[model samples]
Target: MQYAIPAPPPWWSRLLARMSPTEDMPTRGRHPRALVTPHHDEPRPTLAELYRARRLDMVRLALFLVDDLHTAEDVVQDAFAAVCRHHGTSLDGLQDPAAYLHTAVVNAARSVLRRRRTARGHTPPHAGYGPPVDEGLLLAEEHRQVLDALAQLTRRQREVLVLRYWSELTEAQIAKTLGLSRGTVKSTASRALDALEKKLKVVR
Candidate 1:
């Protein structure tokens, strides 16, 4: 008797955590019963390949938010493993899996922040230092200045900016992902932009 095991709702499971959803539908491979096998099934090759494909990008993004490559890698790897554990099969159902993954990465980064806080009571990194880049060409002076401005913002402002402008997520999506009220998200984003604008004007 091969009965299927139903997983929890995708939203509540925290499988992808805070990473943005994927741009394309992730393939979980074909199972005799369904396109995606249930949670208990061994991880399919498609999911593994999918993780491999996205791992590097996720690491860079995580590094931008968390400021440590090693920790970022762990976050990215955890996200992949989670997708395999909880949503591996259902990832194919997602419209924008890349965005989903983005949310997950962001969440995992937050968890990392919480853990770090508990351990060392350190504050999050400043975003106003420069636009985030992953192993790219050296940033120009202006670029460094931009990041410096971003770093000066509160963590809320920086997160809203990254999710809204950098990730292109909607206010509704950002609010839901961050477990905040939609109005709060909008206000935070507005304030963040306002602060950033003031700094940019001064820089110019």
Candidate 2:
């Protein structure tokens, strides 16, 4: 039986509508003063618009960081909520809203990892379950090995590798996002790749 595709969320439609371009008319008849004065009351994009625009990509990023879809969604939600609380309707005021959202999601994912670590420490040794076989099947064996090894690295190393390779961010962007020096980001990423290779028993 054929199934209908799910419609895009309401916020997604609104975001698309907001992004639609309008034709510019001749301003020859308008007063010059009107152009010089910034409209303080102009309707700017809000946290909701940003969220609708970026939520899926942000959640995917969090998933790479945290390795759990539910946790990733929670992380993204918390990130957006934090942005809302901080910026409200003035999201456009931020110099780089996308960068801010990326930083917020990373921070939230780190918090989730910290909490999971603490909980794991308190739990019985046999309480943990193995990852699902379907998840393993989703990637090629080499890719799976890489991810397994990636998970075994230090949190900083994993962050560096994931942000660099998975997110395809430049070293400078990673450094800015993670609040690290450019040299530090380069060294950390190199070390992370080395450690991952060692874990996967790769010659390179």
Candidate 3:
């Protein structure tokens, strides 16, 4: 007897599309490889330039991780402030400022969640988040459903899924950012995807 594989969800493509930043957002923010310009000897972007290019993108990322629009914006702002405090406005001596900023955003979001957990006593950090008001970050109903599913995942699972799919980070990069082994990132992503799909099926 042959067993048939289950069909993937019809909205899977749309879900991925919704997860990505807009097409016009700078590619350098997500892919560190694009920062290399040794052949042409281009100067690295200043911290201000990097912030202008990547701030919104990072906010979108933090939004997914924290599931609150205002809190997400604050998280990205704090990340930038932390980077500036450490590396200066010129971002001198930083091998990869973009990657550094990304890590900072993730860490800041984690801190926000941790504090909420301690104060709220078992409530998820995203609980009672208001609808997003930013026009640039607005989502369709289907996309909101996807985000709701993501909110149900554990923090590590959410981070792995967002970094893997939304930011399009390689497993090695994710491992370094999250301080996890590559094997753990791989397994977490697999399990997260499975859980998310089940949640989406229920939503449908």
Candidate 4:
């Protein structure tokens, strides 16, 4: 007698759909505004405007890296501070402030992780707060499960996956952010997705 294999759950498909880059990503018109370079004629946003727009997104990105909302906020704060120190509040003479800030946030998150590793007496923050809550994005049960699976991945894998899917960064941008080659970023993301899918399978 022949038997059919069990299909993956609906949520698995949803998860992949959410994680995959949009088809329009290859088109210049559909690129993320933050990633796109502004034309000379276009008005540049002030530092405050950029902060208001990107702060929450940056915090979300950091939360995935550090695994704590409070610490993530701190990391983002430090990133802004570093940018201001180097570029000033006016953001004068910087051609790509958003890109610069993206690199700063990634570096800041790395620093936090490094410090946590070195501090012998470091106590992880309490888990009472639970998975991160965002006004615009609510975490469902399956998505929370995915986050749990993500936590099991290596640091490099986690960074590659998060930056690729969550931040919607391209391979080149992820490579520049993590100081890895584009090929490395591509391979790591592929491996990371395979690992993540396997982990999710066990849960499903």
Candidate 5:
């Protein structure tokens, strides 16, 4: 004997039957459609926004590195401008814009220091020489001594120390920022601290 097949339910009925009450329910006061996959082309932050968000901190980092507020501002400005020149408003192009900017500031500060050194080397001792005044009047005694000691450090040593202590970057972070190996960072930091202690005459 042949068996008769049952007819399928109406399309509307089938659709309604397949719908679960929970599946259509809103979650945490949000519509189900609102949970959308983000698009890859979503606009990234502009350079202006990045500069606004990070300029002050960048300037401070430069200040500690270069030890001059005006030079620090110039360094930070040049860094941001360089980013803009290279990437325009598309910060997404950079793997890490903040890191890039940090490196740029460090490089720029090094250039400034190099130029200052060259200028000092060429100047005659008597040309525009002024009588020495008590540094304590200009800076607190402790501050003057600390600055004097810092000035005595090699550029790289000073940079490593400032980034390590003032900026409080980890050895790995400092290494990446300065394009040095972790071993180099550790050795440089140790030697720098030792030299600083000697300059300050701080007893262990």
Candidate 6:
């Protein structure tokens, strides 16, 4: 998966100005919140490696939310930028770095949804997808169906579904990510699932 990254102006590029380090996350066109490189310092490999590790999964998660392959990249860039902004201390203490990145991607997608109420065009369905092509994607068809079902949902529903089924985050985690109450997360996820179930039955 990937996080969101910002794009520079086309005219600026003509002057050949220094560009920020671009870690390719799957977000389409924008990045926000990643800390700018320190004026006089090289980032260490450990942190770089950690970011590299999380990028692809973040991309996948972003793709899930955005649906369009193009926009997915933009969404992830924004997420990573956000991660950079509040990248407190180190990622060393987290029990699961992947989970952290996963949440980040989800949050980024939500931000995108807020900015643009609807995602236009096709977002490839997660649940209905064929087996993952990369060595990384291990989702089965049934699982794919689950993801597909989630994809059919509105942004809020998709966010709740990812928390409940994909990330297995607690209702509290879902609430915190979506800025909803735990009760709301629980209720929304329930409703989203009910909606997904109906959609899945028809497709199946």
Between prediction 2 and prediction 6, the one with superior TM-score is 2
Candidate 2 TM-score to native: 0.69
Backbone clashes under 3 angstroms, per model: 39, 0, 0, 0, 0, 38
lDDT of 5 by residue, 1-204 (tens): 222211222421332233223433322233221112113554455677677656766665676566665777889998888888888886767756656777788988888888877887999877732313542233344544555677688877788776766455677878898989877777777777667668877521
Off by over 4 Å in 6: 1-49, 85-104, 111-148
lDDT of 1 by residue, 125-191 (tens): 5522232365223233444455567657876777776666544467777887677777788778767
lDDT values for all models: 0.59, 0.65, 0.77, 0.72, 0.63, 0.55
* lDDT digits (tens) for residues 59-83 of candidate 6: 6557657654456677877766665
Once fitted onto the true fold, the runs of candidate 1 whose alpha carbons sit more than 4 angstroms away are: 1-46, 89-96, 122-145, 198-204
* Model 1 deviation from the true structure expressed as Cα RMSD, one decimal place: 12.8
TM-scores vs. true structure, each candidate: 0.55, 0.69, 0.80, 0.73, 0.67, 0.54
lDDT of 3 by residue, 28-84 (tens): 345444442112356777788787777877887898898887889999999999988
Ranked by TM-score, top first? 3, 4, 2, 5, 1, 6
What candidate 2 gets wrong by more than 4 Å, as runs, is 1-45, 129-143, 202-204
How well does candidate 3 match the true structure in TM-score terms?
A: 0.80
- Candidate 3: what lDDT? 0.77
Comparing 1 with 5 on TM-score, the higher-scoring candidate is 5
lDDT, model 2, position 19? 28
How many collisions between residues are there in candidate 3?
Answer: 0
Q: Candidate 3 clashing pairs?
A: none
lDDT comparison, 3 vs 4, better candidate: 3
- Best candidate, TM-score: 3
> Model 2, residue 191: displacement in angstroms?
0.9
